[model samples]
Target chain A: MKFSDFICSKAIRHELSAPDKEGVIRELTGALVAAGEIAEEDLESIVGAILKREELGSTGIGRGVAVPHTKHPSVEKLVGTVGVCADGIDFTALDGENVELFFLLVSPPDRPGDHLRALENISRQLRDDMFCKFLKQAKSAEDIQTLLDEADGDQFGP
Target chain B: MNPSEANKTVVVKNPKGLHLRPAGVLAQLAAAYDSEITLTKDGLTVDARSILDLLTLVATQGSELTVAASGSDAQQAVEALSHFIANDESDEEE
Candidate 1:
């Protein structure tokens, strides 16, 4: 559930160039597949499932954050990717603001504990205003990963 | 498959019903299933796969719900979700 346990190093896009929801999901899925976390064939289905979930309500939890996730058969274990958008995208958040931080998660189709843990981890880290501010200012993927490492260590008491 | 045949239905027995907290628990439980799951309540069905969709159902106390799971792991999904409601983990703080 910790960021270090799941966030993909290669999949971390410091500043995503996707302009819309679908495009962003594709970008994330491609990253996951390339990272060997998800099967390429399951990319569309996973994205579709997450989008369907979004229809119920925006994952956008406010303060420019969105956690779009799904439990799909393609994943053998819990996997996640983080993206920071410098320009941000309109995610129809409850707070009526654009979302710049996206945490995309995919877990095994039968791992409820992992899902909750991931949610808890994401929610806990996002609650830190300073951590989020540092994440937003990160200029590269390595920089963002470093920020997450520090944040994860602080939250988990490692 | 007919939704009813997918699995035995379980009614919401919790005193406060399937509010946000219970819904979160159910959503968490549903994520542990490989089969496709759906929760039917108030004549509407929501994808149990999505935590957000499950939350929107918001079935109150005494509201009956049908938890259906399809595909190879149907039985397992039914069991997990049924146990989730039966255990009444809604009262626990996140």
Candidate 2:
């Protein structure tokens, strides 16, 4: 349920180059593939599934965060990666704000419980304004990972 | 401050508890009333108006939730929210 439990450091990126929603998804998924978390052959399918989920409703839950997720058969277990966009992308957020932080999750179709727990864990950490501010200000992947480690350690109280 | 307050304890009936979709429905309903509404479980209280806060509760199936409202329409708000939690049918799609 902790961010560190499912998020691999290899998949974390800082200041992603993509400027739009589709581009962001592709970039983040590509990161996962490069890290060997996802098969390169399944990359396009995963991105397509996430985009289709967005059609139902943007995962951009506002406050500069977007949790774009999908249930894919290719993924045996729940996996996710974090990306920071220096220039925000238009996500059509519920609050009508651009999203700067992206947490893209891909989980097996059978694990709804795990998916919900991950979402809860991510949102719980995000509720702290200081955590969000520090994540946005992170200059490197290591910096972002360190912040997540501290947050998971209860350094930022509930 | 208005002193009229109402509270109800309801057991979550949905198989998935208050996940995103159901929590979103609860938040939307809670936002319709002017009352200050909160849902508490396991000693953690969260504003009912925020989908994010509600999701943080992580209420699984059969979990007990205490819905509380304070304001002019406190009674109505609590009743509606408790009913919604106990009989939510919107999250059937998974």
Q: Residue-wise lDDT of candidate 2 within A1-158, one digit each (tens)?
A: 89887897999999899878999999999999999989999999999989988877778887899988888899889999999997889998777999999999998987778988998888898999999988988999999999999988988856
- Residue A127 lDDT in model 2? 91
Interface quality of candidate 1 as DockQ: 0.04
Interface RMSD of each: 9.7, 1.9
DockQ score of each predicted structure, in the order shown: 0.04, 0.52
Q: lDDT for every model?
A: 0.74, 0.88
**Chain A TM-score by candidate, in order:** 0.94, 0.98
lDDT of 1 by residue, A24-50 (tens): 877887888888888788888988988
Candidate achieving the largest lDDT: 2
Model 2, docking class: medium
